[model samples]
Target: MRLQGKTAIVTGAASGIGRATAVKFAREGAAVLTADLDDGATQDVVKEIETDGGTAYGIATDITVRANVDAMVAAAIGRFGKIDALVNNAGSRIIKSFLDHTEDDWRRMLDVNLTGHFLCCQAVLPHMLDAGVGRIINMASIAGNVGRPNRVGYVAAKGGLLAMTRALAADMAGKNITVNALAPGMIASPMNRGFKENDAFGENWNCENLARRWGEPEDVANVAAFLASDDAAFITGETVTVDGGSIAALVRQGE
Candidate 1:
């Protein structure tokens, strides 16, 4: 019950990492406002939280639009009375060659993955500022830090997200507002379905990390929960890599 009295807003709460984080926060006693583009899916998440004896509500939101973002925040405050934390987990990816990417593709990718987060932060910060304390968690990716193939736009967006996290934290310094990021590597989520379907690719990636297995959404959710809690009150402007130690290890092929 680390977040017993907290109220949190989790974007992209329909599935994957977003769903896991929403459930985890609710279990820890946060009154969560689950926002997602899918109205039905968000309601499902809300139901799950309610079944577990937690307080929560679902709202259909398109974070890329400023109006929708503002409405989502208003809804949260209206239901929960205040906002204590925010998890910017909504994103999109394009697994196409850089040359194959179109201008629309590039712009849309950034709109969902980077700019949407920016809008969400902008909409929520004023309320947080009024309260004088808040936590902002940005869901970044390991690809942002390391090079990867066929995802130039995704890499750029995530990389920019990490940089934004740092800048926001700097600006929030001494304001009792903490901003941080989580860089996850090869998690088993709908976003990685294509790679996981390829047995060889899945097996090879499993060995790329120290854990020798894929990361679960809950793996990252646990860390997000901590960051949202008072336990991490002193921590800010940091990127916590939740990759099963993949970045720290150098496992040679066939080792």
Candidate 2:
């Protein structure tokens, strides 16, 4: 009951980390708004929450579009009467070398991964400010912290997200709005399913991580729940790395 009576909106809630976070919020007594580009997929998540006796609603939202993002936020406010938390969980990745990436590919990746968070954050901030309390958790990646081959746009966008998170946190300090980024490393979400499918990719990913095993969606969800709760009130302008000690070892070795 950490989020009792709170209102939360989770983008990309149809699957993976987003879906897991939405369900986790609902279980903690929050009125969850689950949004995804796929309406049917979103509804399935809503149905699951309802079956578990939790309150949730589904909305088909294309986060890349400002109108869609605004409408999604509006719907959540309409349903719950206030916005308490916004999780910018929608993201995309295109595996291509910098030279191989086209203008369209770069734009698409930036739009969905970074710009989407911008639009959602802008849309939710007013309500959150009016309420004088809110949490904005932006999803980032370890790739943002370190260079990765074949993911130029993704790494760039996520790096920008981390910077934005810190900037917003500083700006919103006195407003009681905590803005932070969660940078997960090699989570076993649908977004990473392709790597799991390829033996070489999986092996490389495992070898890079100190845990030697992939992280689950729930692993990120657990951290999301903590960041969204009152316990994280004093924490802002920080990027919490939930990478199973991978980053620590990497930095240590590099030094």
Candidate 3:
């Protein structure tokens, strides 16, 4: 019961890492708020948590909208009493070269991936500050740390997210609030599966990843669970790489 009596809000909880984290939080004794654009899918996750004798609620929210984000934070507070943790997990990727990308494309990617987290954090931080303790985990990518081909917008947005995490951590250092980011490497999510089905992207991904295998959603959820727990009280302003050693290992000589 690492998170017993805590309330956690997980965005993009319709599927993949968000969904897994929502369930994990519930199982760890936190009352989970699963938010996503897909109402039906979110309800399914809520149902799953309830089936396991855990408490959860699902809300359909478009993170790109400031009003929606505000409403979401208010809903969590209204339902669960107070916000203890926030997992900014809603994001998307557009695989296109920088030269080929349009202004609209870049803005759209930033709106969802970067601006969404900003809005959510703004919406929840006041309450967290009032509570005197909180955890904020932003879902970034290793692509943000090192550039990847044909995903300029995603890389830029995630890089911004990483910087945001550090800045916020510094801003709230002694306020009992921790801000951190998770940089996952090639996790096998539905979005990545769609990209992998396309031969070109798949080949590029395989070549870049030294592990030669995709990471599971739980692989990330486990790390997230730890960060959300009190065990990571001393950890903040850091980006934890959950890439199965893909970024750490060196290239073989004759590969």
Candidate 4:
């Protein structure tokens, strides 16, 4: 297995892409520490992984809080003995227009999507540095790369994450640590179930992508496994888009 004997901490792992990544990491031979605010849900995920013969643990964590972030790091260290990778996947989005977005909305988006990732990175960096080898996968979005009309705060937060990925990669240069971001497309995760329910929204995304279908969380999770593995040792500061050609083709595949 690619991740044999490694340890990974995955945030927002209660569901969707986060849960998928945690399971994938564990299956690939990593001891996974899954963190999310939904304790029962995350515990369920760990149980499922354990049932499948994977090493996994779950913790209730609010990434927006520093104390919680500290506890998360400590839990991983205490349970797994060392940290090999950190996947900053915990995030939230508000579907409101730029004009309709309030200050509080903006703060909430930035707090969950950007600041939370920042805090987690800070808390885990020292341990990674101590180990002398690490991978940090920050979850970004295609909306950040291409502006989405109704999600101002989400776009801004993810854009900031993209920049932060590059900056941290530079900071970690020569330290045997790599920082990268994964820009997922319109994934068919529970987080986007609302959009999926809306015919117009779902149709538009499907039509926009060359794949002509919504992306599955596993699609992104597969890349997560690769990025967290040594196979990506030479990669850093890169944003790998898992949108199934949505960003590349200005013209839709069939259109």
Candidate 5:
């Protein structure tokens, strides 16, 4: 139980990486607060975790809203007594070319993917400062590192998130708080279902990574658990790529 006796708040816990991370943290002995806009799905995740003999609660939250973010943090502390970690996993994407992207799309992407994290961190950091122990894990993407063609707004938002992660980590130095980010690649998650459904893109994506297949949500969740645990105490200001070597290799199919 790496996270034994801890408490965590995972935003976007209704599905995909967020849900997986919440379940994983609970399984590792952390009391989890699963926050998401999807009330039914979020509660279902809480049920799954509880059925597995883990501790969890569900809250309907829209991280993009300041009031909702504050409420989510308050709920965690009220239910779990203390907040040990905050996983800023809530995100949005706009897969459109730069020329086709509208002002609303750009703002929406930044609002959900970047501003929401800022609000969550602001709301949670005070509690961590009071306790003198905490973890902040931002769920970034490999596309942030190496930009994607059609996802202009998403790339900008995630890239900004990466930069924000480093800056926050630096700010929390020597504070017993570690801030880190996870950059996942080609995960078969609902967020990327549109892209994955395209046969040509999916086939190419399957062969682009060293793993030669799509990554499961569990794969990223496992790493998230480590970051939240004491094992990563000394590790801060780092962006751990959970991409199966997709960022490190240029795989050529039919080689």
Candidate 6:
């Protein structure tokens, strides 16, 4: 009930980390607006929240488009009367080697991962700014900080997202709007289906982290919930890494 009476808009709420965060927000008493490209999937999330005695709604949205982004914001405010938080959790990966990547790959990555965050923030910030308090949570990736194979474009987009999160926080300093990012490592979601299916890759991640286990979607969601709550009122311009201490550990093979 930390978020009681607050309203939150979560992008990419159809599945994976997005769905987990949206559900968690609702559970914490936020009136959640779950936005996703899939209408049916989004509705399912909405239903889940409702079944749990939480307030929520589903909107089919493509965050890369300005009109859709604006409409999503409008609908959220229209239903909830005001918007208090935004989780920029929508993004996809382009898993290709640097040489194999084309201009389209780069464009798509930035459009969905980076540009979408920009557009959503642009659409919702005026309301937050006017209210004099708000939370903007951006979903970044560990690849943004560390090198990853066959993910040049994804790395670039996530890196840009991290930088943008910092810039937004700096710009909003003393304005009561907090901007932050969550960088997750090896979350066991649909996004990492291939790795989960591969025994060697799965084992590597399972054993690399100090926790000796893969991170669940709820792990990141718990942190996001905290950032959205008053408990994190003074925390801004930070990128919290929730990776079971993998980012701090240097586990080498055969050593």
Give the Å shift of residue 17 in candidate 1: 0.4
Off by over 4 Å in 2: 202-208, 251-255
How far in Å is the alpha carbon of 106 misplaced in model 6? 0.7
> For model 3, where is the 10-residue window of minimal lDDT?
203-212
Q: Sort the candidates on TM-score, descending order.
A: 1, 5, 6, 4, 2, 3
Task: Predict model 5's lDDT versus the native.
Answer: 0.92
Candidate 3 error regions (>4 Å): 195-212, 252-255
Residue 24's C-alpha lDDT in candidate 6? 95
**lDDT preference between candidates 1 and 6, better one:** 1
> Runs in model 5 with CA error above 4 Å?
202-204
lDDT of 3 by residue, 7-86 (tens): 99999999999999998999899999999999999999999999999999999999999999988998999999999999
What does candidate 2's lDDT look like per residue over 1-255, in tens digits?
A: 899989999999999999999999999999999999989999999999999999999999999998999899989989999989999998889998889999999999899989999999999999999999999999999888999899999999999999999999989979999999999988888888888888777545654566667888989998999999999999999999988877777533224
**TM-scores vs. true structure, each candidate:** 0.97, 0.95, 0.94, 0.97, 0.97, 0.97
lDDT of 4 by residue, 180-250 (tens): 99999889899988878887765565657778778999999999999999999999999999998888988
lDDT of 2 at 39: 97
Residue lDDT tens for model 1, 155-231 = 99999999999999999989999999999998898888777888768645655788888898999999999999999
lDDT of 6 by residue, 1-255 (tens): 889889999999999899999999999999999999998999999999999999999999999999999999999989998889999999999888899999999899999999999999999999999899999999998888998899888898999999999999999989999999999998988888788879777645555787778888999999999999999999999999988888797976566
Q: Rank candidates by lDDT, best first.
A: 1, 4, 6, 5, 3, 2
Model 1 lDDT, full chain set: 0.94
Give every collision pair in model 4: none
- What is the C-alpha lDDT profile of model 5 across 1-255, one tens digit per residue? 999999999999999999999999999999999999999999999999999999999999999999999999999999998999999998877777899999999999999999999999999999999999999999999987996898888999999999999999999988999999999988888987876888767645655778878888999999999999999999888999998888797778776
What's the CA error at residue 137 for candidate 3, in Å? Answer: 0.2
lDDT of each: 0.94, 0.92, 0.92, 0.94, 0.92, 0.93
